[model samples]
Target: MFALLFSITIEAKEIEEVVVVGAYVAEDIAEPTEDNILETIQPTKTFMLGGFNGIQLSGTDTKHTGVFKNGVPVNDPSSGWYDFGHDLSTGQKVTVITGANSVRFGSGSMAGVVLLEDNFGRSLFTQIAEDETKAMVEYDYFQIAYYKGTQGSVKSTNTENDWYENKTFKAGYDIFNIELIDYYYEYDTCYDSNFAVSDDCSVEGEKLNVSIDHDRFTLGYTNNKSTHNTGYDMESDRTYADITLVDMLGHELGISGQKETYGERERETYSAYYIWSNDNVSVGYRYEEDEHIVRLGLENDGLRFSVGNSYRLPNLYEQFGDSWVSANPDLLPEQGYGAEIGNDWVSLYYYEFSEGIDFDMNSYSYVNTGSYISKGIRFQNEISLDKGSLFVYSEFTDSDKLRVPDYRTKVSYKYLGFNVEYLGEFDKGADFDGREIDDVNTFNISFSWYPDFATEIKIEVEDLLDNKYEFIPDYNSGGRRLKLSFNTIL
Candidate 1:
């Protein structure tokens, strides 16, 4: 059985950005490949500004369904790993939908699906404050960051030893009416030396949002923690509330609820959605219930669909202790049912092509009767180069053995800015233990110069001609590199 269909369409005049459901939203999708480019989009691995409301998607692998903010279901619950780049900041906006459209966000979507939108409208330091409730408490903002990177042979006899480090901190506040968020993250890695891994994460939260002009409402709580070095320590504490009603007759309604505790394992969820629009066309429906869980979804613009059924009653490392990292204590609590479909389109004018392009294509399929199933295809193209822009993307997946071909071509001919890329993974028809393996390639090249004000600097020389490839199976992924970055914005 072989089903592979590829398509591409382009029409550009881009300018659509401001749709932060849980944070990052930018129009025109597709451009990634560096071993599946953070596994096929969904915030391209991570970026964030606010925390939770409605809209949620998560995946990395190991079938564990996620999505729900006011109704609490951001997963992890012990090795489900929905890390979404650990609380993104810096003008946050993220949207990723990888591998099988993640069944539109229900039932572990098999290594893909991430949608985070949290930008809570209007900012520029709240337009100079002094008015809208004191500019929401003196326009608050905070950030702390640290990053370090290194890869292979820096010349010490070549057996290859890698390195990576990241530390982040962010804080936000909107006083008087209350809105606060705090985040912390830590990741450390060292490969080829056999074993060295560390991941630490934290999130603390509060929200009581309310807006009156177009109508809005919110209530929230989140306290989450993850610690792992292999010993794995997981904790989740949740509480939630949400309400949204917008009417001019065109209608829009949303309601939410949540309560979760992991340690002893406890659960609860509730959801509701409704919509009607005016423009071209729009429609929506959503329903959710909790205890054992149930969900239903439908939407229209191009299309969006959803269906869910769940029954998971056993947790706390699956009925108590003996954690060798976890699982199997009579393990059973993964019941299922799933569905999702999607399509999107935008064109201002297109007949032959003059000099404008923005196109997107997405396809997804999923099935789970006992446990796992997935199917995926994604394509995207964007071109507009006078100052900066050129992107191409392609993705294909069935499940796991992961093969990706990614290319990003960029040019800015003045002040010398150029980029050429080819990201790897090609196992053709893979099989293990029975033999058939040989097809791997990885490549990258980059150059930049911005020589002027607002403090700009760039120097990147990655994998220029060193390719030893093997992205996740005895490790050893790409080599030879030099990167330097500097930016200033106030």
Candidate 2:
């Protein structure tokens, strides 16, 4: 799974390297350091599709990926998919990890993990209590951003608008912390009325999240509900609690648990886990869905290796649903084991580069539609220059049925106050309905400008070439589209 860390401190440097995943990091806080995350998240990948930034590992569909907001799994319980459509205005840094699973996760992370963290709590209060030695009453962070997207093709029938806002209030008590996030989004599609179809189809949704931490323990909750004009609506709620402990040997220990309610059926499910870690070794065990998961890892200097086996519970739709022809409730949970080893390379224009390979064998992969063994090799490189910086990422995966890009790449350049980035993917065709589909190649480009340290305006264009091919049958590409967003701190 992926992890996101929000840092408010900016290293003292001249040419700060900037990287943007789902959230953007400026030069002020982009310099790498012993304690900074600049080097760890050097190469960032994000996709802007429809109304939100899609996951690179899941293609256009987000269900193939698992997402966690502040260590709590947020995928829809009924579908086990995350839209990634919510506004990240409350966050400062967003990280996505691929090809590895950590003790922090339970199920639904076969593809990878998406992490969203924020500094709204620390930055908002730490500033008011600026006196390094005292706590003050001044504390709060609020932001509002508007997003609009329009289809570029004249024949297009898609449009989107979103209004998002967040507020964080702290009392500077240091003993307790609470933060809340609220988001509302809506999108519309036009259908041919002549064919007895609804002229306009719209979907509206809202999400509310609350997190409270006291001392060494934290409790979090998320409620997400949505409605559709086509009579398909759903709601998912999740609650999680976790605590940290330190043993006599100075090793850290963590215990956490989660419970979720799926659909109106109200079927409840839960999971629990405990993990312990020292300087160079870590071990964890978790229980969920009548399955046991064990994880082991070791790290020394710049070399690291890890191996783990976990199971994914079948989503609500997979067990009992009328949308599909044959929804089987007896389907078994998907289980798999993964292993990886890598080393960081220093002393080059590329501050940090890592070459690693992993293998995952699944007994019953829900997304892949069956059992299969997949092997993947990952490569990451980043270069910092005087005027700008360059980052590169490539991965090769060998699998059957599941359609994943054979290779992908991203490029970024920052000069003066403007940033330009591009991401592209190359995927081989997968057989469907007794026919060999054509290979699909897609690319997206984004241009953003920072008027100041706290404000940014961005314009992004997806599917620049307007490729009409679809990864799945009947799922027509939305062609070329434009999205404009304005964000700032208040």
Candidate 3:
């Protein structure tokens, strides 16, 4: 995103290096959060729900993608969807693996995998938007973060405000070839009845994790629990244990398991993987939920190629959990295959899903109805100019399935200390079943100023032209919005 890029520039030569605050994303479901941050960060790769509560790969649904922290999944174990964090700032190194390369996690990665790892330094950061403010402080191997947001809907019949609060704590210590990390997060959100799980009710969640790393392997344990105010006594206690054996001359192995007691029902899962890699090539295999997949990849002289299978197992939320829409327990698992070949400048790929799961606006529930074949190409290039520079990136995808677009293009220009970008999405000139979606375009500008060696101040404007179009039916991607960000080395 422009905000992140500007921040990176300031961080490179100004302040002492600090982790980019890339934490939680959603502010309030009653009022969808940033299209500004999430969209810009991976515009062509992701599809959003009109800048609202849902986002996933361009051709995949939320349930098909997974979010992991330090190699453990952070997605709600019950929903199987990554609903909360789309794009907030954090002090972590974020790595995204998609297409055939996603076999690293085996199942439940129909689209991709997002991995987050601790990468912090002594620093302070804060960003403020129209309805929210987030701040964080870090020192050595410790971190504390807080966020608050409030929203009021414009719908006359549902004119009420929703609020959200979040807090995070992390600490780590290393000695004698052994490392220990402790992390905790607390989330609370209350929304109006119309768009809430329960009218004017609160949903709270808590997580704590302890991990130990040794010369040969890593052992981790997590106690995750959350309570949803759905007009009922809804709460669950979940536990996870994992061990990973590091590479000893190109050999690696991993095993993980989870168990959760949800009211009268119980959920459990077990998965593992084995991989072998040297300097320029890697091969791996994963098994989960009675399904197995193999992946292969290689790179040399700025060229890359990969091939593998993708799969996912449905979770309770997709089948029976209640939310803004009804649940469908009849949903089936997803299976697919994909391959890609390209280099640094351009790439071509293909993927086909025999059975893909997704949220169907027509049925108002989850469905295995997005299956189809897709082919695509990507191009990225940069040109230097007399004053600044110009960067161009574009992708065109053709899918036999509905609910997906065929083209996306992004052009950005940097002049002096200011950055401007333009994004355009075009719907395929075809027909489909559910809600009729339309094309959407957005423009943005950002500027950063370093007042001192240890500090930076940046301003950004999203949807600069106030263009309103429908990427999702009946939802209005709001008008222009502004954000101010500041960070300093402690």
Candidate 4:
């Protein structure tokens, strides 16, 4: 095992983006406009169940993860979780960071951050400036798409059939740009509704983004609104602003603030980050109203080391919501510190591999007031020969129930545009309602075929081995189930 590890890490660069918990480039997982990129790329070992149809980071109970779009946090202010059902057809790329502690994202970043990027309008300006064709000079684009999905049922009463519609437009000139999107989704059966079966649930939403770029500075604004209707009703409205600057001395600065109103409550947040970079090292500081974070690191060639401290405030729902469990107004915010080491290696035979180890300690455990500690190690290896390539990834996490996974391994083979992958996990035990649930093995397999450069059809099966497990007692895992997706860009 050590020889295999050594051969893989020999060519690894220290400053390389750690695949397990660091920045991820969207193109590596799927094409732009693809759906569920998070579900496809990140190993399940990093996430646990979120109610029904939601995903939250492993090891943390409440939603401490922040989902940022174009540098602004977009997670539901009240619940602190990004709506997994939100349409992403308009997005350009996405980056997810898990178990990360940073000062730039203030309140709810104890678990991690997910950044969604969309710069279609800005790209159009560059295209017009570079293209000589008359047809390419206009900066206007519009798109419309529809998708449908179905899944078998666990309960005898209902099956899951879901579909959604999407439309978007981008238009603007050189110094300024605007983008708009309209989205809608409906469920055939009231399977996950908050009301009766007769009143099937549906959602309608709209988003608008405007930006101006000049010299070394940029300014932007975003507005989002959504409505959900069943027997009961719910609605949300969010507004946010961002500013960024790059100075002559190689310093980068950014600040963002937001206000979100949901149901009968409203809240606001503000955060900023600044960093100085030189040839071999970088230093940075971040501040949220509730927490302070700092980072100091040095990278020489491909080897890197860094240490940092992070703090997070309790979210609105955890402080006020009344549901299956009541809120605790006296709850204290969680704080922690962590460090990482990484290396990039390349084998003489051209096989490439990378490895990273991370250690984290928190002031309080999820859903409990006691201190908690966790350690994680991850590896990725790739070998290419002829027209085919083999990729392997594995991870191990030693932590408590909310975030415990003994081990996970994934392997994939790609050749001439066809790909197949398998993922499996050995999960630790969890407890609910004072009863301890048994540990279990989980398995999944996925296949993808790209008939051409612009089309993709995929099939994925979850829990292929039928190992029954639950994050919450009586809420058994979705057993062997099948899902299919057809995605394309015109």
TM per candidate comes to 0.26, 0.67, 0.75, 0.67
**Model 3 lDDT at residue 367:** 80
Q: Score candidate 1 by TM-score against the native.
A: 0.26
Which lDDT values do the candidates have, in the order given?
A: 0.35, 0.46, 0.59, 0.49
User: Which structure among the candidates has the greatest TM-score?
Assistant: 3
lDDT (Cα, tens digit) per residue for candidate 2, span 1-490 = 0111132222221111111111111122221110112222323322222244445342312454566554456677666666554443333345655433355555445345656443342222111101111111222433232233222221224323222222223221222223333333333343332434553455566666655444355577777776655676767787877666643463445566666765644455555665566667667666676777776666677666666664666666666553322345666666556555665421100000111111123322233244445555666656889877766665555544344566555566665645555555566455444444444455556666779886556666655777655444433343554555454545
Instruction: Report the Cα RMSD per candidate.
Output: 24.3, 10.7, 8.6, 12.0
- Winner of 3 and 4 under TM-score: 3
Lowest lDDT sum, 10 consecutive residues, model 1, at 126-135
lDDT per residue as tens, model 1, 1-490: 0111112222211112111111112332222111111233422211111211112222113324243332234554433334433332323334543222122233333233444323232222111111100011112333443333334322223444333333443333331121232333222232222345322222232222211111254444555554444445556665666556554565566666566666666677666656554443334444553332333334455454444444333444443432332333454454544444444321111011011111111211111123343334444455666866766544344432222222112222222466655544444343333334334443455565556654344555545676654433333445555555444333
Report the C-alpha lDDT of model 4 over 1-490, residue by residue, as the tens digit: 2233223322211112222322212233323323344554454422221123344443443355566554445566555566654443333455655434244455345444666544332111100111111011122233332333322222224445434554555554443545566766654444334434542557777766665433433455656566666433444556666555544585768776767665676777777877666655666677777556776555576665555665655555556553323545666666666555555421010000011111112322224355655556666667896888988877666654353456667777887655666666665555433555445455656676779776566666656776655544443344565555555544
Better lDDT candidate (1, 4): 4
**Of the pair 1 and 2, which is ahead by TM-score?**
2
Candidate 3 ranges with C-alpha deviation above 4 Å: 1-41, 44-55, 84-87, 129-131, 150-164, 173-238, 260-263, 319-331, 359-367, 381-387, 400-403, 428-433, 469-471
Model 1 Cα displacement at 270 (Å)? 3.9
Candidate closer to the true structure by lDDT (higher is better), 2 or 4: 4
